[model samples]
Target chain A: MEIKILGTGCPNCKTLENRVRRVVTQNNIDARIIKVEDIMDIMSYNIMATPGLVVNEKVMTKGRVPSEREIHELLTL
Target chain B: MFLNPTKNREKAGIRKYSALWTGILVAIILIVVFVRFDLFERLENGVNWFVFGLLNLPADSHLASALEFFLYDSIKILFLVFVIVFLMGIVNSYFPVDRVKNYLSRNKLYGFEYLMASLFGTVTPFCSCSSVPLFIGFVSGGIPLGVTFSFLITSPLVNEVAIGLFVGLFGLKTTLIYVISGVLLGTVSGIILQTLKLEKYLSPWVKDILSKAQHEQEVFQLEKQSFKERLPVIWQEAAKIIKGILPYVLIGIAIGGLMHGYIPQGFFEKYIGKDNPFAVPIAVILAVPMYSNASGILPVIQVLVSKGIPLGTAIAFMMGVVGLSFPEAMLLKKIMSWKLIAIFFGTVSLCIIISGYLFNFIL
Candidate 1:
């Protein structure tokens, strides 16, 4: 599994990354996580808002963080 | 495919929705009851008396009275912020204003187009920091220099938080002027800069990008998201805003409270008062370096207006901090050339100054 978090290091972005990390660790899932901070790099994903989440090359969410259960469910899949 | 997670807590989710509805119904009933029984007034009066008692100083103590006033004002303003921010969160959830690449990439736009773009910028929610990325996105996507400039200014300066706080703190008339003037400042500056043919001022990296057709295919997907898909996200965003801004609100209101209690009317009148026509211009200069978020600054603005400072002069100071902060300008340097940065600030500063003077004279 692969997850990419996109933002320019705002507070919300930081929180989202931390949450994703915690969820991944707790689940003990074999997943690769990447943080994308560059403006152009993130835009290439077609997200208009920060703190976007891309899972397996698919954009999952943008502008807001998903819930813990939501993350857990996504990982389980 | 990623979004449809089976409801693991279907029971819990149902209960939550029911609870939400019940809470709303209860709130409505409570409001009606409070209005009929004058419970709200009684509650407020009691709170005031309780604050006085808590201070435990003589009524004549200037500092004690000021503390009381600060407590009262802060509570009121905080409550207002909480309600407005929550509603705005829902609105934002429903009407997500995606920065349209197609519209922004236009080679040339009429004056009305610039006005519309600036106004759109005002209504969409964004902070100064987040706005930098949007600005970069617009510029990189071949958004006209002037139109992009307008979005850059309006995005940070005139958002829901600023406008809501203004209306709650300064009343409708002043807020109307501030909103209109803020958007107009963006529009006029955009037109002026475009006329000067300042596209050369943009960073070479941004200006050189002419990938019109290839980049067009990378459009934001999720336009067809169901309400269920977005509900949790909306709540999360609204909660983030309230939590993030609450601290600043308290701190701002505390300062405002102190200003109200301790500062004499004559003190303000003497310094940045109406007699000093330079007050507005001075405020514009002072506010840039002291830049903070609108949430942090609006309470202080409330203090200035309450302190007998002219509306226009105080507004100039507010615009200064909100519109063009030193930090934001520095950040813009990433994509904007030195000349472009200078032009952006120069035009905005001039417009802010003019607005300050206009408000002072008219009102």
Candidate 2:
């Protein structure tokens, strides 16, 4: 699975990235997590707020960090 | 189809409606008690007694007054912060950024759009570091540059945290003036910048995105949850915000306490007093490099006002500190040219100064 975390390196973005990583590791999910900090790259995702989560290139969430269970569910799904 | 998974928690039933009504009922009761019982005055008196009578501090001493000021202001300010943030959290969960962005993009309110944008900025909670992505998002999403500027300018200046502190520190009249002035600053600055046609000054990367952004924009699917389901998240967010700002509030109040008690009445008056014609502009100029959120600065502003600084000058300084700062400028540098950044800062600083002078004149 491919996951992209969209942000401009804000605190929320960092927390979201860490949460995603932990969920991936603990659940032993096969996924690559990429942090997209570039303005152009983040804008393309159409998210007005930081800490967006993109699962398999589909924008699953933007503007908030989901809980670990939510991340695990997204990963499993 | 993937979005539906997130909506699994949106339970539907009479229970949800009942929860909503219960919340409203509780809010009404709190407001009734807060208003009818004279809670604020009683609290002030209680603090006064605690400091003077209970602690056995001399009534005439500066230390007693300072201690009283700190305890009263901190409690009142912290309580106000929690209530305001919690309420805003619920409001935010319902009107999420996605919905707000969509609304702004799709609507054409003529000149009112700028005001609308500014209002959005006032309510939406995002860290200052998120400005770049938010700027890019609004711009790329076909929102006009002026409207985007309105949001960018007002987002930091007028927020719930600031509002709460302002109300606690300066009471209703001054707080109202501050809020109205903040919104006007954003709106007026936006209109002025919009007239300049600064589109060409955006970063080349933004230009590239603009060139290619005309395609059918994807509708970001978001889960719709009832307030009941959103309550837990909202509570957490409110708590998090209160925790984050608690330190700044206490420190600000502590400093304000010292200034309140010990600083002679004419101390600040001798320097930035109302008699000084240049005080407002000087305050604004001096505040440019100092970065602080409203929570940290408002308490200091209270003391400055008490010390005989014109209300206008101190408020201008507060706006300057809260609204325009080097770090925010650095963040904006990501999406704007040096020329654009300078213009943005220049315009905001000018507005803040004018506001300071106006405030001094009126008050």
Candidate 3:
């Protein structure tokens, strides 16, 4: 599984990134986590709001950081 | 070294000085008359038409009903904007900058703190202009630039006026979504800016201020006054801000009230209703350059929503108007270069448009 955290480099984006990392590690999932910090790259995803979560190339959540359990469910799906 | 000329020279110098002062006074009076009679009143009256005419519509006219819808739904929005600004002024005065700095600086790269600040900012309802001074204080006090941005972005976007308008017009569910979205955006944007190592992009002056945190000590050194002393200061600040804003408020209300009483029904429906694909973008573009307080724009938004305009599009438009007005951009020019201003506008505009689509898709 591949999870992408999209943001420029703000505190919330860092939080989301850390939370996702924790969730992935705890689940023992073989997932690749990537952070996109470039404005153009983030914008290319058509995400105006930052700290977005992209799971398997589809935007799953944005603007807010979802809970670890929520991420687990999203990954499972 | 010259001949004996003291007495006559003194009298002549005094007379020349008096003549010069009289000439300056006459010029000033003439200029005041010209401005008052020939320019100021005319401009004021002309601008008033834009504000009032939008509200007053002929009964049979196509726009009358649409205008009426807005007028009726904007009262809560007006109340919220006023309350938020007032409260923020109080809070700003109450909490000294040192305290905020100490709290933020205690932790290094704590994401949770940023989120909290963003949430607090959203609830406060300060406009971008009013928030700038606070932002300057925060960043200069050694708080992370990203954390400051979190507060700055959310303050205007999630203001009380927007919330009140949402609650009154769309009810609790929509209001909740709006609040949640605002917090998320603020937090995420803050974190992203942090990651990019963009703090270096800030002006050298800002860096200099932050480096010399010792200077801020003087700000806190003032004799700590009791709550009683503080209360008067708070009241004075509030009164000053209110006095400054009252005219805009009245102007906004007058237009909004008139719109409520007039406007034709279904007029806006045919043009930018929910089904229109271009409605979202068009609304975004139109709202970007416009300037108005929350109270001023609420009536217009209410009418659009009543005419079946999509909720997301209307929200995007409102955000554009309130969060990224032309006036704000112009004012920011004093603090930031034109390039930064353009980037700020572009980034926020894109954010709003995407948020609009996201809401439309989800809700």
Q: Pick the candidate with the highest TM-score.
A: 2
Worst 10 residues of 1 chain B by lDDT: B213-222
Count the clashes in each prediction.
0, 0, 21
Off by over 4 Å in 1: B1-43, B52-58, B99-110, B140-142, B211-232
Model 2 per-residue lDDT tens digits across residues B1-363: 576643544544444556556666766787799999999899999998898889999989999999999999999999988877877776666566666677777666878989999988887885777788778777766777888889888888887788888888888798899989999999999999999999899888888776655422455444556666888988888888888888988998998898888888867777777778888888889998888656877898888787787889888998998888898888888878999999999999999999999998899
lDDT of 1 at B359: 89
- Flag regions of model 2 displaced more than 4 Å: B1-29, B212-222
TM-score, one value per model: 0.83, 0.89, 0.55
Instruction: State which docking tier applies to candidate 1.
Output: acceptable
- lDDT of the candidates, in the order given: 0.73, 0.83, 0.63
Angstrom error at residue A42, model 1: 2.6
Put down candidate 3 lDDT per residue, B6-73, tens digits, no spaces: 97667656654554454356546755775578643454455445445755546555355434433443
Per-prediction DockQ scores? 0.36, 0.64, 0.01
TM-score of 1: 0.83
For residue B38, give model 1's deviation from the true position in Å.
7.9
Q: Rank by lDDT, descending? A: 2, 1, 3
Q: Give the TM-score of candidate 3.
A: 0.55
- CAPRI verdict on model 3? incorrect
